[model samples]
Target: MDRDAVRLTVMKHDEPWAGAATTTGRNGSVPHQVGAPGALAESLFLVPTRHLVALRDVLRSGEDPEGVAVELGAAAATEGIGWSELLRDVEDVCRSVSGSLPPYEVVRAMSIAWTETAIHDAYETSCEDPLTGLASAAHLRSRLDDAYRLAERSGVSASETAAFVVVEIAAGSGPDVGLLRSLSMLVLADAMRTCFDGDETIARVGEHRAVALVRRSDAIRGYRALRDLLERAVDLPPLRVWVEGLPATSDAATRLLGELGRGASATELG
Candidate 1:
């Protein structure tokens, strides 16, 4: 059987055909209908039977497929496509190439895109926000549970053990707000580390807001000290500082963060 004997028919997104990858020949490029909905998707595409669309790039006939692979990987991740499924797709592509697993370089590039997007998906509903290096609201609730549990064992209220020291930075409505907010938070986080010691968890619960779990025993005293440090380290105008006592339960504590997070500038320490 001649491996090159297959008759490949490349179809367009605008074509009347329903976007199928039906194969009829013994050897040739396998054509899958491009599903992108755009008038700009008029470019012609012919894919190898192994489903390796990069064959064009590999054969120096069309645009780069590296970006395509990345987009596929990212799309797979967001769509909740599993690894096994992705491997099957890879296998189809490989059949046109090595007829085995995908080439290491291609796999690496795709895997990187997949992993990055997958991690973002996890972070969206999980413990931490990668950009801010702070605990998500969900993470804070669990930490609160631990604090309350320990407090219970020690025969004290949660408030006796934990409190939130919040820092809210004020930025103008200018276009630079995102950059300004991030930089200000970094400065605030650094000051938080210096003043709060290592035991507390710091979290960003709202835009331009961060809260560090502080020892209520020292929160009042520490607030004044941290306020002094923030003033010195940050030249950005008007930083607000306040201490919020933990409520009776972790549930309430999570809600408290929302309330404290509102408004710009300092309020009297409560």
Candidate 2:
């Protein structure tokens, strides 16, 4: 199938007959009807049959179908689309299904689901460490940007709410390289959850360094948590370490991560 053509159709639903309902052929792309008032009905024909089934199940289980549809549609989009139009589509679908789910509930569920799905996908694809399940540095930036934007929109300065904690883990001496790396990951996961909570953003940028972004107010507490995690590192013998605190400035944060990468690779004490 021509992905480009299908992508084009996904983006522009301007024509009344350009959607799934209007196009009927055995071709891989589903036929859809494209129009304003009937957009939801058209969308049903456009989404893949399996996805449609999953969507139906969500609705049947007392979930908001409109919200589920918005997430599923956005999730499936590999190409770019106008954010305004996408949001419009979501609003329209939610309104159409208002009878099944409360209007406000549909709005809330879809908004949250959209955000959660987007975050999870971004972390999975761009920000997770394949080796140990820690977040990657790029993902760290994305997380910070999202959080900072949220704070800023809510009338808080970006710097007022965020802090960075860099944990430099010294590897074990001798031939216990594998054990050392495993220990580092364990320490990271524990420190992340205990200090920053499950919602906190943490990342492993190098073999010997992990960084966590915490609430600015929690800087001291976060540091204490790191200390505890490091103390547990004694199980790996030489895999001990010192911790450092840094402000989570957007630009400075990037530079700090870079410095950490170089410093951790060097023989300097943390």
Candidate 3:
């Protein structure tokens, strides 16, 4: 296709192009080029606005055509947007730009990119707590299983110990206290992240309770650090904290979770 006609079509559709100008076609028409003269022109396709923007950013960042296509696919999947047409457009663009890169390599990259995005989306939805924005109970269970497997493989100790700490806030009868309780939950969550180096699995399993799983070696220290941090927050309501240590096994973790749930409604801290 004529370069000028292709450029005009892309411009009309508001697709992104490289910022360089190549040769003007016949009759004094300036043809905007991407990467090379006929690179983006060969595609002559339109993608979703967000995907287009992401593609432009990736291109401008100077990624190779295959890498750019991978990022484009990933960006589309992350935004829950379709990318079949977008991938075709990108493959066309890449083929036009580079003759050396194999078609199979491009397809593989795109597949890997979208698959990773799907896995990430699943992890976020299934293993993340919506309320406190921490790892969910399911995630904690999975981590415990991994810890046990690791311990067994290393043969260092069959009875690897871990701690499960639960933090509960008292709900006042008035709306003002309810607001205070909500704010305190956020503050306490922040404190847990800071005290634990943001590595522990903390989850809000109930309206008034949050739980954290930590290595037994650091559990008492983490608990002390959290207590000090919470003490500084004078405006927060009374808190109740329960700490328990157990072998890092599936049954032990389940029992600890059950105990934490049952005692989450205990008397408030003085």
Candidate 4:
């Protein structure tokens, strides 16, 4: 099939696949294991959009497919999908392009890429992500604690006054997808900074994830502006934005935060 046809075929399934991916199980996302019959594409659709684009490119150009494979690996890591599952997706995608699939070596490339990025993220050893200059996860937690305390003193429910603005930005697809994600985060940080225009503790909680702690009163206006600005953004996949109310207690809020960064959908959070 031609490139346009390939992309269209993949995109045709987006609506139903999105519904399935967002459906939750014991965890907050698509299950790590193979699910029910005909579930391969359901899981594949949850992988980053760029990964699918790269795979399409691999079949079209037949150049440095390993690079595409490794990117798929990184995307899987970010999406919390497993290696075996990704391989299955690759095989499934093969059936799309005249039974031509990238060899198993592509899967090996993915494993290596995932491991290297994981190790780098593991030993980050900073209060801010060096890549995006957003507050560290630890710092975000501390800020949450402080917010809860201030709410306690103000005699209003924290849920009434404060909420989280979570934005899931889909970056442009490319061979250097890691860089694409980082670059998009930079754009997102600027947009959040401009829209919130306050002491919002904006954080890059996970790959493709960002959150800002903002006053609920301001959130309605801020979210409107944020969506406008991001919608005008060039070269990005669709952005997902929502203002989640603070959970009942600080501990519960923290637990929710743990899931937020890992690409949990709004349905799961609710």
Ranking under lDDT, best-scoring first?
Answer: 4, 1, 3, 2
lDDT of each: 0.62, 0.54, 0.59, 0.69
Candidate 1 Cα errors over 4 Å, as ranges: 1-79, 82-120, 125-128, 258-270
Residues 28-59 of candidate 2: C-alpha lDDT, one tens digit per residue: 43433345452444443233334434454565
Q: How good is model 1 by TM-score?
A: 0.54
1 or 2, which is superior by lDDT? 1
Instruction: Specify the poorest-scoring 10-residue window by lDDT in model 1.
Output: 5-14
Error of 2 at 44 (Å): 36
lDDT score for residue 74 of model 3: 82
Record all residue pairs in model 4 with backbone atoms less than 3 Å apart, i.e. clashing: none
lDDT at residue 42 of model 2 (Cα atoms): 49
The residue pairs that clash in candidate 2, if any, are 19-32, 19-33, 20-31, 20-32, 20-33, 21-31, 21-32, 21-33, 127-136
Candidate 3, 1-270: lDDT as tens digits: 111111000001104345654453333323335556444543333333434444444545655547655876686567564556556666555544453333565567777888889776775568776556777666777776776676778874324455566667876677577677678878888888888775777876555678777776776677667776776877777775555544435575565555454553332210
lDDT of 2: 0.54
**Per-residue lDDT for 237 in model 2?**
38
In model 3, what lDDT does residue 98 have? Answer: 58
Q: In every candidate, how many clashes are there?
A: 7, 9, 0, 0
